[model samples]
Target: MSFQHTDSIALSELEGRAPTHSDLESRGITSSKEKDFKEDVKETVADSPVDSDVLIRDGVQRKLGQRHIQMYIAGTIGTGLFLGSGGALHTAGPLGALLAYVIVGTVTYSMICSLGEMTSFAPISGTFPHYAARWVDPALGFAVGWNFWYQSVTSIPTEITAATILLTFWDENINNQKIYTAVICVAVISINIFGVRIFCSTAEFIFSIIKILLIIALLIAGLIIDLGGGPSGERIGFRYWRNPGPFNRAGLVESNIATDQFLAFVQIFVQAAFSFGGMEAIAIAASETESPRRNVAKAIGRVFWRILIFYVFGILMIGMLVAYDDPALLTDTGNAAQSPFVIAMDRAGVKVFPHIINAAVFTSAFSAGNTTLYSSSRILYGLALRGQAPRFLTYCTKKGLPLFAVLISSSFAFLSFMRVSKGSEGVFEWLVNIVTIGSLISWLTINVTFLFFRRGMIAQGIDMRKNVYHNRYQPWLALWGVLWLSMFILVNGYAVFFQWNTTDFLVAYINIPIFAALYFGYKIIMRTKIWKPHEMDLITGIPSIEETELPREPPHTIGGKIAAVLF
Candidate 1:
């Protein structure tokens, strides 16, 4: 009932300046005989007003701040760092796993930096998905939007399955896994239905603090164990790294030593990619973020350092304490017993710590699952507003809840039931592989979209110096991200080449074909063209965005200053 229509404004703004044939040719948009294509695009956009303003869902205001964004990211860290690292540890050895995480982390940093720059200019919901439509093609936008929504929807069940598994860490003899799963599903859905302020400001903030405290405690305990301060007074000191050797055998082979190690490294590389999947949640929160441009800029700048502390340092400690061949790492119970962090503590004779760590793991899993519902529903609502999805999804309640979208997204939580029959570990890995592939494509789309965005800005003569947030080495960073991600996408199914298992191949490579079908199918139906560089709407929402003000300056007290730096 409260939707803001962009049609009239977009129609007048774009129709006033249809690009001439010469202009199109100069920008490499068309062949000499393809003049009709340019006119088609001009006419199409002129009639459709792309919504440039943030739709006020049920009177919700932008209230999320820097602290909220940081904690949201922290909660998104999930249980992967604690439990899922076992597979990587076994496959790649300590050094190999560490290198894999470092590589993926670097790529993710570059990707989010590019996104921050773009979102600062237009802090819209469906952020990069909207940019894809404007700067590239409508069909690309459609494909990416739905792909991301699907990824988020699937991730909910994955985290629920993980939560159930974490409970098992305390009582392996328990018989109520499904009951636990249902409780988590209902809790997260309820949190999302209450709208952004409660979810981001309270529930997520508290859960993230628990997560941060747990990681810090683990880090200190790990250091103590490595330094001979544990109950056994044993100084582990990278003993595992040296003994199992630096690299595990690749292709699960023993004789083909070099090849086996290389394959194993690749396996670890992909697992690292999966572990870092949800770190981009801050970008999704841009529409609801108070002083979005400034806050998002601050958050993005700090993301890399956070990754270093939580992931790189955490991985380093795990490597020091647990050997790749440890029987604990090989357990498929889908519980915290397999957590390298728990394993490390148990090995040091700290028997009680594992229970504490397992409780924290449950908190991390539930928080991550809660975040997925928010992101998925918001994405669907954004799509509905843009006419890419069923219009009912855009309907919001007085509390700013996208009720229909939330319900639809919550329905996917039932997917966790698959674990009941398929086995929790197997089903969890299935979900992880699919999510990893989808996220990689999403990252690739962000980079390519940013490159086009840069071209349009330069073509329109917008000065970057005066902008509040701008990345300096863009197009290059984007270019490298695209190239690197492309290589990984091609080789994501490398395991199949060695043994040729049908399930493994499908799980690894199915997303590519699915994405292709969505992209081309939409292209054919809409008759859209690859948007030329000079023709993109690069400055549509700047005036309204500029009028927004921060409620107050960031904290200036001594403790606040320290928080500003550390967070």
Candidate 2:
């Protein structure tokens, strides 16, 4: 096998002395491949006699346990599922919307599984960006890291905006949305700055409990209403499905009814992307979780089942109880008014239900914004550590919080102030539109990176049996995931093609060109190669990571056993 070498002085050398080219040459230090420099730096740092505190402080401690991991998985049940699904139900019929979510869930599970396989072996803060560099190219890593960071950072303001909107459901007289937005942003930032255990894990655990309980309550209520147990004793079991019909006739040209329904189904498929956006956050928490290799692997295996029960089943129940043509679902009011679950209860004459559901929805949005800040900040810190971002971003507090990165990520939350401008709502919407596609892009990259990573392992003569975690199906699942995600990305904006609107087109497809610019631009600027399998760094950080002892098993008490199984 041919080899490529770089004169790059890894970060370890930066700590030793001024990183001069001549100084590096004097030591005869050379990296075998440009793509593998990160591994070389990690190995050098791990073996160096320099203070371990330097490296330790830059990275977070693994204070999160199984309960925390479970909370992180459920933390993002926000506007995407609560309010966004209303659009799906409106555009597509009940069955079409349900099918859309089910399909996305399948693809999301594949993406999560791929991420889990890579992270279990090397639980680092850099996550997929590091994997992209290791398995693909350094330039690709730079692009993916920044793209994901922006996606995560921008989402905080989106959630904050959604939360403020939800709050107004109680009293429309409240005119100052900025006050609520600013306060929520500040609160989320403070929680993150306090350290992961105190905030990310604890807040998520509490919020997830709130979300899960509310969802369970909502589902039980829906079932009872469907069974003729409401105040009017009216059974609504699939009645709406038969009346407004199971399929929606949605198209610009007014074509065949069946064809239009199919088109609506496709549109819903794309819309479902946002609902499952942050579901892979479990993999992102790899570095912060206690016994990450074991706990993350466990979470990865179990989170999908939980998602199916909470999200998919909830959607199914909504379909059974709520008609697609319900007048309340057509509102642009922007609150619990748009939630099908709330609308169904209101239609069934379930007084006082909307208030309870609205409160739960508000909590979901807040928790989602909190997780977004945490994820985005860590991505920035990881990028800085890998030399893809500014050096100052890697600065962490004594408590292991990436304070600088947190500040930068939260800065975007102020964008919510655009709501005050009379005519700037369109501008704000445009900015918001640019970010929604990022999650799909991230999913595509994860699958591609996983493919290369698997090949690298085989090429380097590593034994698959020794892996800490591996997906059930060998490359096929990842291949299908990549193909499906790519298809979804390309055709996500199909509605624009039927009748083009410049803004709608831009909103649907703009992220593609932006991602292309970043990827090819970085590749051209750096002159990096698509990494060769033999050149991959399969074993660099593993030795040091394996040297540390794994956490002891959980206690054998009944509560511990239940936690062990559920988490």
Candidate 3:
């Protein structure tokens, strides 16, 4: 799977320089030349193993395992189920929220498969964006990489803000959210700066404890309350749904409920997507795994059940255990003091549970933010390796950490405090909206890239049957993902643009225009044109599956074995 640094047909040979749109038009390079230029760029770019090599260091150290992947996925599942559910319930009503989650979850499940298949085959530090450039089009690669980077950067602050807000429930006198956010951001940065294994191990431990404890506590409390043994007295199963008529008091078409509900559902889809955002982070780390192909395949295969159990079941529990119509649950304060989980626990007669849940929620938010920092830094490092960013970002410390990238990524969280200082939440809201849009765009690009990658594989006579992981109905799945995501962008984005009362439409929807500008601007400046199948990097020829295999490890010493058993 190693790429030869030198090739017979260099990028310069295809285009006197990197072909710009003007150059393509003036040189009269027909569709054929355009395709050739794209292919050449892709092949040349793909030929280097610079980023992957640095990430794995010749595949010597293998730290991530099944547990790490499992917890990593759980970490991404988030406290959204615990806290964010109330908002969804209010917007869509009980049934609407349930259906909305199901719909979005289905799409997410499919997307995870598509991503899993790609990473299982061509595990790399850059992950999907690199594949987009190599297999689809260079413009697409550029768009996705930057879009994801932007999403990751902006998302850090929101997570931190959530952590700070949650902390306030314990002590109202803690006024310095910015200071706390800064401190947490620094701590996460330090963890990531230590290396991927340390970062992942910390994430695994934190997320596993938080997720398991929360779910267990909720299950136990729900059972106790349902069995008529709680402080609140007898069972309340499905009583809330019945009284609420399984829908919000405000109908979908009603001014406050209809428009708001529909829009809120759309926004929640984005939020759900973002909450599941770092699932792909598992694949990004797969390149460094001992057995990337097998492990990634196993991880992706379990995505459906994981989402069902952790997300679907968890939300269903929330809906059943707590009244959707509770005013406390419906509050849109977006402050931590008003967490639905905390309120739900209080109402369910669980003494001291709110504090415990708040602490876990804070840890979960911190974990989410910390993981985003790691993901963003790696993405930046990948971009640098491809010459898309400053080369300095590609440099790794002795511990294999992207120090500069971590610093840059972590700094974005500081901007979260702008909402408090500016007296207008416009900037913060705009950033959140942009993160949504950017993430959607990245997802769309990944699907599109997968479609092209599948085609290139087939054309090159690569047998899909041989792959342990395969994305069924490739072109169809990819096309559907693209279409649905486009609808999300347009339908959701149009509101931002046309809604006259909205203050940050320009900032919120800016990612679309910015992406278009980058694509066309790069095309015009570099004369880059669309590519065809033959001109695609078509790394389907490389046997990455064979190249990546699990390394053997020595048996644990007695002390290690005892620790393993106890732990």
Candidate 4:
């Protein structure tokens, strides 16, 4: 595997004195792969690193460009934000839910900052897990990689369910939701199987642009409704917050109102985490992106705006437009009708726009599902490259699509059809719980992994901000993420204890033991050691001196400048 991105140290573009054998020994950079890679960098994450004498093309294609990276990150703005946020609002009230999202958004942004720093330097498909193996513990990598893959598999169905649920807005009487699920599933799988080039450049980019436009439109429309721009001309200005009183006590109310409301707020963290779940796919996309060193950093740096416009503003608007206690929010129809945006429109005597919003949401669900499938397949391929998954999973088509990996990942999405027997809304809740647990786990692991990455870089005398992307708050920002994420992960399943529901408990916390088993089991069986900071493999993926090219120029045209700043 030959990595294509040029690093400041590894690339010949920046002239500097090369480190001598004695200089390297003094720094304790003892990895044999690190030393050997200086002469011949085997870099692509598409397959195992091979000998330079007889190298092959990386299995995955680098087709995604800056535009694709921008929209792909925006793709997570789907069912969770548009539809599921109503549930979060219902559970946590207006202010409570608003605060929950804001808190989760902060931690998520920190993780993205840390992720951007490394990906700009060593952009790879497996992403955080691969970083873990090189910078922290190999056992942690094995466990986290599989955990992340499971998270990806489960995410596909959650989005599928969201799409099927949205279809009920058109025909609530259709009982065979399984048909809708299967149809949606086929559409998503087909787009992915079409190959990464068409998948990202065409279908994926279109999906992202549509979602972004719709989100902006919704934000504007929501603000208007809040200010009495509707047919009814009713200014609902925080009236719901006054009457409902900004806190919804959970069903686990064996305690006082404050405790129950606290539990309710705690539960919303899970929902919000689910809403912000797919940020890591940005780093995952780095391996397949054209010029990841430049484009991936640009995409990640723009995350603050994405979260502000897509989540924080949207949450505030939802809270102000609709009352948390509205019966419509908890509806069993599990479609667009329960959506706060739809509810706000309906209450404001707005007729046609609900359908329009519902259609946008329908598109959002499909786009999110497509992203989940693509990320999952690539993750499996990454695992195969590391010898964690089966070798057959690494096989790719001539166009560089991971064929077997796509098929296997698509198979897991069939779980969406389980709603045929379980019912749509119930199944949606169950799957959301499961997926949220997986997402929180993945985020916490990424933060911890970044901490280790930072220590290794510092110990090896690598400069964080010298020609490399980095946050000044650094290890502190990552620490903040670790602290909060761990708290949420622990408290997520606490409500189940009050209610004593076996299913909820299992769905909410089962990943913990499974993750522990995988981590410790791999450690004991493989006899892997926790890598020290100086011993980490930081240079393997960096470009060798021979691989550097002329530096990229600044954007000259208006269009190019717009893309440079926004995408």
Whose TM-score is greatest here? 2
Q: What is the lDDT of candidate 2?
A: 0.78
Per-residue lDDT for 1-567 in model 3, tens only?
222221123332233235465645654556666776556546544553222223322222346765576566766645566677767776556666776677667767667777877787667667787787667666666677887888888877777777777767765665676677678767777777777787777665667667767776766676667566678786777777787756554233455755655555665565555545677677667655667787777777778876776667666666676666677875654544356556656776676877777777778888887777777877887777666778777766665666677777878878767755656577677667656677777777777777776776666566766677886666566676777777767765444444454556665567888888877776677565555554555332222443556553534799866633323
Report the lDDT tens digits of candidate 1 across residue range 231-344.
999998978877978888775666788888988888766678777887667888887777788888888887888889888998888888899889988887777788898888
**TM-scores of all candidate predictions against the true structure:** 0.88, 0.90, 0.82, 0.88
Instruction: Specify the poorest-scoring 10-residue window by lDDT in model 1.
Output: 1-10
lDDT by residue (333-413, candidate 2, tens digit) is 778888898888888899888888889889999999988888888888888877778989888777778889989998887
User: What lDDT, from 0 to 1, does candidate 3 have?
Assistant: 0.66
Measured by TM-score, how close is model 1 to the native structure? Answer: 0.88
| Per-model tally of clashing residue pairs | 2, 0, 9, 8
lDDT to native, each model: 0.78, 0.78, 0.66, 0.77
| lDDT (10s digit) by residue, model 4, range 342-370 | 88888988888778888888988898898
